[model samples]
Target: MGISDTSTGILKGLVVIAAVFIVLAGLKTATNILVPFLLSVFIAVICNPLIAKASEYKIPKALSVTLVIVLFLAIALSIAGLVGNSLNELSQQLPQYRTQLNEEFAWVTNKLAEYNIAISSAVLIEYFDPAAAMGLAADMLSGLGGVMANLFLIIITVVFMLFEASSLPKKLHYALDDPEMRLSQIDRFLQSVNHYLAIKTVVSIGTGVAVSLMLWVIGLDFFLLWGVLAFLLNYIPNIGSIIAAVPAMSLAILQLGPAAAGGIGLGYMVINTVMGNMIEPRFMGRGLGLSTLVVFLSLIFWGWLFGTVGMLLSVPLTMIIKIGLESSEEGRWFAIMLSSDDDVEKYHTAK
Candidate 1:
């Protein structure tokens, strides 16, 4: 290419980068507004099936919506109560754990000293504060606190979204020129999202329950809190499972001996491996999957833009973008680039 052509292309790339930065900045700034709406959209998607099932029995739409909302509120309230009780107990018992934590720290320092690698207890304490692990868990809970604060707004938004969802296809038909094609694309996207959320919910619940049972059997403190963390973080790919395990494992080490802690860690690994690696893929299949790199990048990008809720919704949001891109004539190439090799090959083969 000519120098002038290369310069023009570079300028266009810079413009696109700047535009993306601006959009991200806006999203971060308006998080209070956007987070609720995004959450509502997801809630609406998840609850739509329940509403449909209720309606299939000739139930009125208002009654169906009310039934779904009531069920959702009951579940939310139960989780809130569990988490609140767990945190209250944890705060009261933290002083007891601190002594055990210090003992463990000393043991580690002594082990390192055996190799002629002397480390001071002060330095070790400074470097590894057990409270920090609790802080991490607290931060996750705090994020949930933010969501709970906005619960009413989110619920209202979901109710409206559900009502609009039924009429959306007709609205799109009149608004778009190629109504059939557009409706088909939208339907496919919704179906993909619904299926993914349903399967992921089941798998996450299984992981959480299994982990909680294992922790209980192993005599760990705050098993319910850890189980809830696992359920929530399981929404994020890769590092999420590790994040969920660290706090529980740290508590295990403090409460039990190293051997028991190791067993607890092993239990986490097996549960995550079985549920995330084995079971998820069978249900998710190739079509709904993103490239591994894309998954990581989406986690970082969305987390940066919208915080923890964004991280939780990252994969689904990226999937929606990919679906939208694939439906457009000019954007299909971008979608293909976001797909795994297997998916890319399938797309090409279909072409």
Candidate 2:
């Protein structure tokens, strides 16, 4: 290559690196601004059906919004209360758990030693480091003020969003001067988002309840906390079920002995297997056909971008992208690639 061409290439590389860092910095800054509003929008969508139903009875939209907000807040706080109680109980028994955990570690080391493999529980612990874990947790807790402040903002925004939802379309129409087109687009967008959220919520609730009941029957401590965890982590997809199962199994082992732990683990596996393999497929009936790699990468990317909230929002965000692509002819090919064969077959049959 000529010297000029080489210089141009180097310039391009620098530009690309600069662009990447700029984007990352922008995202980190924008996260605080966007997260709360996005959360509010999701909450508003969840309550949309109730708002519409109440409006059919000639209830003013404002009153409907107020009622929905009150009911939602009450339900949220009740669940939170249960979780808080469970956490307090767990804290009181931390010494027991700690003792059990050390014993378990010793047992594992001894078993490995039988094969002539030497392992130090202390060394293993230093490598796996609980102190670091505590430090990270302390940092998160220290940020509680900011987290709560943003959460309060989200709630206020959501309430107003619901209240103004009815008039939003009219305002958009006036601004755009293309009412029908804008309305059609908005309706489809909302429908797609709402449908996905509805399905996810039902699935999460079922998983949480099933897991909680199983733990309770097995005489595990903090059943409510595990249940709430199962419900929340169920939003993560693929890896979420496994993540939710681990702590419950640990608690079972620590409290009910090895046999109970094994049984609880087996039961959890069965529940997840049945639901993930059979029930979810029957209800969802083929996904929008996102590539498995794409789905996983998006999970990681979005999780990094927004933390736990991003992970919870991952699938919906991916679905939104899929819908947008499918809307245009050029992008239809991408949507097709994302679909499973069964979904394609079903869609064809329906057509």
Number of the predicted model whose lDDT against the real structure is largest: 1
Candidate 2 residues 258-288, lDDT tens each? Answer: 7997998898788878777677767553333
Candidate 1 per-residue lDDT, tens place, 1-351, comes to: 699999999999999999988987887899989988999999998898888888889999999998899999999989888988998898888778878778877888899999999888778677766678678878877887888898999999999988887887788999998899888888887888888888888998998999899998888989988999899889888888889999888777667877888999899999999998999988786437589899899999888888899999998899989988988888999999999877888898988
Q: What would the TM-scores of all predictions be?
A: 0.92, 0.79
| Whole-model Cα lDDT of every candidate shown, in order | 0.86, 0.72
The CA-based lDDT of model 2 is what? 0.72
Model 1, global lDDT = 0.86
Predicted model with the maximum TM-score: 1
Off by over 4 Å in 1: 1-10, 103-120
**After superposition, which runs of candidate 2 have C-alpha atoms over 4 Å from their true positions?**
1-24, 101-149, 174-182, 286-291, 328-336, 339-351
